[model samples]
Target: MKKFRYIVCLLSLATLSSCDSILDKGPLDAFTNDNFWTGEGNVSGYANTFYEQFLGYGNAGGSGDFYFNSLSDDQVGRDFDQYPNNKGVPSSSTTWRNGWIEVRRANIMIEKVSQMTTLDDAARNHWLGVARLMRAWQYYKLVRMYGNVQWVEKSLDITDEGVLYGARDDRDMVMDRVLDDLNFATQNVKDVASKTTWNRSMANAMKAEVCLYEGTFRKYRKSEDSQKAPDGAGATKFLTACKEACAAVMAKGYSLNTSYQGNYNSIDLSKNPEMILYKAYKEGLLMHSLIAYICSSTQISGMSKNAFESYLFTDGKPLALTALNKTDKAPMVDGHLSLKDILAVRDKRLSQTIDGVLLYNGRGYTRYNVGMESTASSGYGICKYDNPAIPEGFRNNTTKNYTHAPLFWLSVVYLNYAEACAELGAITNDDLNKSINLLKDRAGLPRITTAIGFSDPANNHGVSDLIWEIRRERRCELMFDNNVRYWDLVRWHQLDKLDNSKNPDILRGANVANDMSGCKADKVGEYIDGSKASIRAYDKKYYLYPIPSGQIALNPQLAPNNPGWE
Candidate 1:
């Protein structure tokens, strides 16, 4: 018989509902220590719940934390007045508080699982390895948005008097906590079936991500005193950690997807060798956010044109005036170049990362979702995770009906690898060959020599080339995963570029219409919205999100706004 244990007092807004009160909840009478450690299947089932929690952590109903929308570079809603401006109140901040709460649950689980001593050494280690990894996973998210944050080693008992009050820790300390957990897991965890399982490879891949962010952030902005610039040597050391972690995964046999499209094709995802680890969304297990493009009129109010048009034509045709381009006006050439042609002679990844082709009746053709027409736009939604054969209208909205949401994947591993290589100035032909070859092979294109640097110094790409190449690939490879243009700008110290005081043209837009074939042509690119209405630049202080106002009021130490808010 299957036994169960209910943990009361779950933490985090996006975490699993454990128990209403940690102390109030009683352990299952069916099984205590005597029967808990009996089988592999039982232990594995518990691990599975951790995976499901990643989706519930985010706001699917568009109400909770709304972190997804806050990351949008497309448009801001008037309904939530402050967040549009990036000003959030702590008391009202679900994402802010939930993140901390979520990490605590992970810590608690790790503690509980470790204490189940009935298992042998190997089995015990396996569970411990995953717990360590989950600890790292939870911290990685916290560090990313909040910068320096609080770290807890054990689960807090909500019923305890001390549970209600906690203080934030220094950023470096939090990072150290992440590293501690990752390093321990890497050493103890055994290999598993694939990235899909709660396995060792996924944990290591996560370490690579955290290391890169810390190293880069510390190197670039390292000020002995808060206002000073980062030291040079720090950058080198950080990149070293990033490179080693990426190479470790590469040695473990991870590679990029053969086709740029293969990385995302719903049918191809489970088998994607390039993905280190990703969350599984069974038929009834997840929520679909891909509906944003479901239909222009009839489809759910999804698919923002602002987000869609950011994708440039693969052949260097700039969709955004701020982006790089070859032509002056829209449709400068015939039929707004086909997806294959736009990607011509450029990096093979352009097609692999975005919705570059259309599939119909088991055959792929040139049909594309034109932004202006709800019918045509709905004709082909992003194939990233959708089952192609499932008729067009079945599960297109956010009613929790069309279940599927991926938390992570191996593509991130490859991207992280690419970033490290480019930073080290050691982007060897072998490196490019490995990365691009995987993509080209999938696109059915002939692989070329990796000698051509997308940021070749000979091409006068300069240091900016490295930044552009990595960031561009990131945008193309990970578009609509609830991440895109805006944050990249913030990370690269390019937030100033968004400032209207200096670069008024960055936010410029144009009025255009579609051709008969369902593609919009930029007749004349113009900047209709100016500094007053449309933003050209961002305030440096806004780089780190505001420490929700309500949070500060509750705990003086906890609520100090990120640098600029006051």
Candidate 2:
């Protein structure tokens, strides 16, 4: 439950008023009626409503969409919760992030579609599958945000006190139900040959992600649970499912798009191979201002220097190897080496993902206007998702501009496949070509030989060389999308990077004294002393957001709000 109380409360009041006085009503909300799901177009249109609320397209970098990465070491944002000072600000209201409303809406669609005789069983099931997938994704987010949220499979009436004010379901129970939704979606969703819309492939992509998250999360956060649930999920069971799910996706034939930058910054990705699913933006129709956030003088958000340097060198070596720093000339602009120099000689993604100008596929791209109010909060500016082609006239309004945003792509599937295999130590040489090598091929870096991959320079994740690099690839690959970095950190139990007390590594940006100048201290956060910069506080309870007090006030079953949140 997040800030959705007022909407639900108002609807309940209206229903009660209508029940009390038969003639007091104006026109009631028409969408609630059974006849709405009558036809293919109408049912499809109803399904499309959830698309508007989908977690794709990065949500335009606002406080409302509130990038969860702001809490992780990967990003810095305008929100106080994102600051590095020793403070804990768990959201006071979990109702705002609630998925119950959406779940109810989805359930309505599923219920109405079930009764419709106009459409054939297959057709009806397709719409139902869509609803199921949406519901599952929504519930997954809810469960992730607030553990053991109220699970509603069927739409409940306002008067149904038992289910309306129900006890929160066990997270394991909720996730199992979520998996059931996913299974139904996979069985019923028609296999379409396009990436623009959801289909079996899209559902499979979501399944892979869900399974991966659940597997890794359960593995790392076992401490949160006193006893393992009846469900057989553990490190092995879920990881196997995760690996198989990715294989299912690969069997669908999604390959990496040749240009990684194009995957993020392109105006059109309708035909891109790596693009498994994306939100299209036609000017004056459905567009967004994501680019405006990126091109800003001081981008509202910043990627950490840790995240920035995580990109391996152009020679397929990590920055941890100082030998690469010694012999390999870090590319320099002018005589002096700026942070951009690290980018110039590092992995091609460096040029594609961060600071200054990059020339990719003969297109000249520029970002981080140095003269403006400091480029990035962490010194290293995040230039991802910037579309240079957008006209200046429309840049101010995100709606009027047409910049297609990536939601799901095969590159993630690639990372997923590699990570799962690496996690299980089942990675064969052939698996490399199918997974990590595809990404390496795209980046034009050397493919991992057993000798080079297993060599020294262990990453801070404390995993094996291959697994660490696999994770590093994932971190750099999906940094700005979907708060994947935060999820990854949480799952890997590597929040140590975010622990400012033990080490000041992530708290500080690129350079303590150099990078954060002229920018507002609030935006840049507290760059205390000459060494530590971003000093964010983290408590174990911060892992799960606390359920809102108002919610608990309505239903006491949601009591003992997540460990530290109270």
Candidate 3:
């Protein structure tokens, strides 16, 4: 409870009559109505609090629940129930509740920073730009989730009777407000070189992301006879804007990480080239708790049953029915695959995401060291953030921790560019070539096509084919970046199109007898477990998570519960 108190403090919602003096200097200090607007650093620090909130929810809990496996082809956990369950989610509320709180804080910073005479025009403008940008980011998440929501431009006092009873805003009104904030941010924000932290680039990236989503969502939302198709003229304009925004950062010299493992496996800031706007975790933040909580007690993290069955074999079954194939000679199961043979050609990212090797002892993984359970039993303990240098005997329950998680990375920008080009019908060979080559070449994989079996830049594909390729790339490249998986399905409205089976059928029947041996009285058994078979089945209603029942009773205007929940 004390840990979550930091969130309240950052939002200025703490019971401020007491404990104010002790936490005043800390980042979690409550913003009293009286002394809230003081110095430039205080304003900036308050703005930083909003960023901290985003890091807390978007990447930490949201990513684990939705991004990692819920929307992926991995196993889905059985104990889960949410909206878009079996294709119908309610329209009453949204998944992101605190987004508005962050927006309000950013607006407060924007308003107060303008009056800080102690800071020069240049510094003040820069800080204001960041505040506006952060506010836009908050709105972006809102608009993406629930089309039209109430838009609030100014920061409201929670204690204000008017604020506590405010109603939801129209969707288009929110977009206009987001655009207005972004326009200000884009013009006043200094170039990437001038900024030190991820503040400015993220602001710029938010503009691109919002424009792309609005353009695409608008195109898709309208009726077929309503003068807008999926590839309409409005979509074209928005795609152009996305291209320009992403290009600006690329011009500023942001590039992909050369090695996939290094990008996620290690937590050092110097080596991380892909993260544009991420929250940096220090020792006390315990941002690591979110990661460690999902893994095994011996390792780290505990995966929910809904998240456990998201992965599948090419045949679309869970791991119980499918076996991990070592050779590429068998019949291609899921044809039109992203790569020629996915099992044999494991993506470079797989190593970074899973603990395929044992970590109990300080030694490399061997064939017989069956200490850790696979994705089925342990719910896919994502090892991407684990630091191998931590002493092997040190249990994750105590010493192990993750320092940071990127809220928005450069890879998404590339994806935005790819999607926009596909919508525009201007997806040239050069575009696909550059996009896929940049991603694949960096990861040491062969970019294969129908004409060229692998890495032949001469073989260029059509826009449709490249779109599928890009989606696959994004799935593999940006796994667990945020709550991207669930939202991706929502944006495309493809949640219903998904086949919700539980297990991987491919690895189930393969030569696994050698891989199933047990060690010393079943202490180190690699044998297949019965639980893996149970996770292979799918439930349609697991799409949008339930809006907490308590929230529904709080406001009658907020609409009813999602489809699957009673």
Off by over 4 Å in 3: 1-23, 26-36, 56-71, 78-97, 157-167, 192-198, 221-234, 282-287, 290-344, 355-375, 378-382, 393-395, 448-463, 498-566
lDDT of 2 by residue, 340-378 (tens): 555556778767766652211112124432222324554
The residue ranges of model 1 lying beyond 4 angstroms of the native Cα positions read 1-16, 19-43, 56-85, 158-167, 222-238, 282-292, 296-325, 328-388, 395-407, 425-427, 436-464, 482-487, 498-533
Per-residue CA lDDT of model 3 for 1-566, tens digit only, reads 44234335645552232224434776664655556666665555555554444543223223432223443333233223223334334333434556666666676667777777788887788888888887788777766654445577676553543443345565556766777777778777765542236355776677888877766665554332122235456566666777777766666567777766555544555557776765555553543444333344442222322222223334322334444553422222222111234333355565455544322111112112222322322223456655545433321433344445556667778777777776666776666565655776655565534232222121122224445456556666766656565556555544433443422321121112222232111111332222333232334334334445444454434444433454
lDDT of 1 at 116: 72
lDDT per residue for candidate 1 within 132-184, as digits (tens), equals 77778777776656665666777655453243345677776677777778777
C-alpha TM-scores of all predictions = 0.72, 0.83, 0.69
RMSD of each: 7.5, 6.0, 8.5
**TM-score winner:** 2
Worst ten-residue run, lDDT, model 2?
Answer: 357-366
The TM-score of candidate 3 is 0.69
- Report the number of clashing residue pairs per model: 32, 12, 50
